[model samples]
Target: MNKILLGGLAALALVAGIAPAAAQTVEFTVINNSSYDLHYFYTTPSNEDHWGDDLLGDSGVLEAGYQATATIGDGSDQCLYDFKFVMDNGAELIEPEIDICQLSSYTIND
Candidate 1:
């Protein structure tokens, strides 16, 4: 039965080697320094077809000179996303393929 024992040990080692690394969540802040209030903030997985719901829900508009903490991490193991800022006058600026884990904050200014 030594062959069986060796096979089991090898299987265990392979499983350990293929196990995923530790999870991480990046908490970043969004600062609004422009002249208009931030009406909505959107974020979605970089690979998705649509943007998720407004990240600023219920917190009200983010006025100029204010900041909000935007936590960026996927429980589904995604690490990249697109971020968008919508202003009060229906203008929007989008930054695509943002590695949210690499940012501490973002600013929208004139």
Candidate 2:
């Protein structure tokens, strides 16, 4: 993982207001070990018809060999979610029915 991401995680772990283990918010780490840079990350509740938005934002990029934390707090208390990882070359990887409540991290690997 990149130093920036690791440092951010360390700082976030120190901050107050982080949700407790029983909170509805699902906080998990995303590891990018694939060959391509990750351009965008999208997550939506399993019951939703549409993906809400790119969590990585417009300019944010998760380069290969890097990792980032994703927090899903839609206020719905949903545990199951669908994830989309878009690569820099326009390739997309979709993972469905992930129970974020039970996961600490997700890895995208070749």
Name the best candidate (by TM-score): 2
Per-residue lDDT of candidate 2, residues 1-110 (tens digit): 34544444444344424555554766788989999998778888899989966766555678998888866655557788999989999999999999987999999987
Point out where model 1 deviates above 4 Å. Answer: 1-24
TM-score, cand. 2: 0.78
Where is model 1 poorest over a 10-residue stretch in terms of lDDT? 1-10
| Number of colliding residue pairs in model 1 | 0
Deviation from native of the Cα of residue 54 in model 2, angstroms: 0.7
Candidate 1 colliding pairs: none
In angstroms, give how far residue 108 of model 1 lies from its true place: 1.0
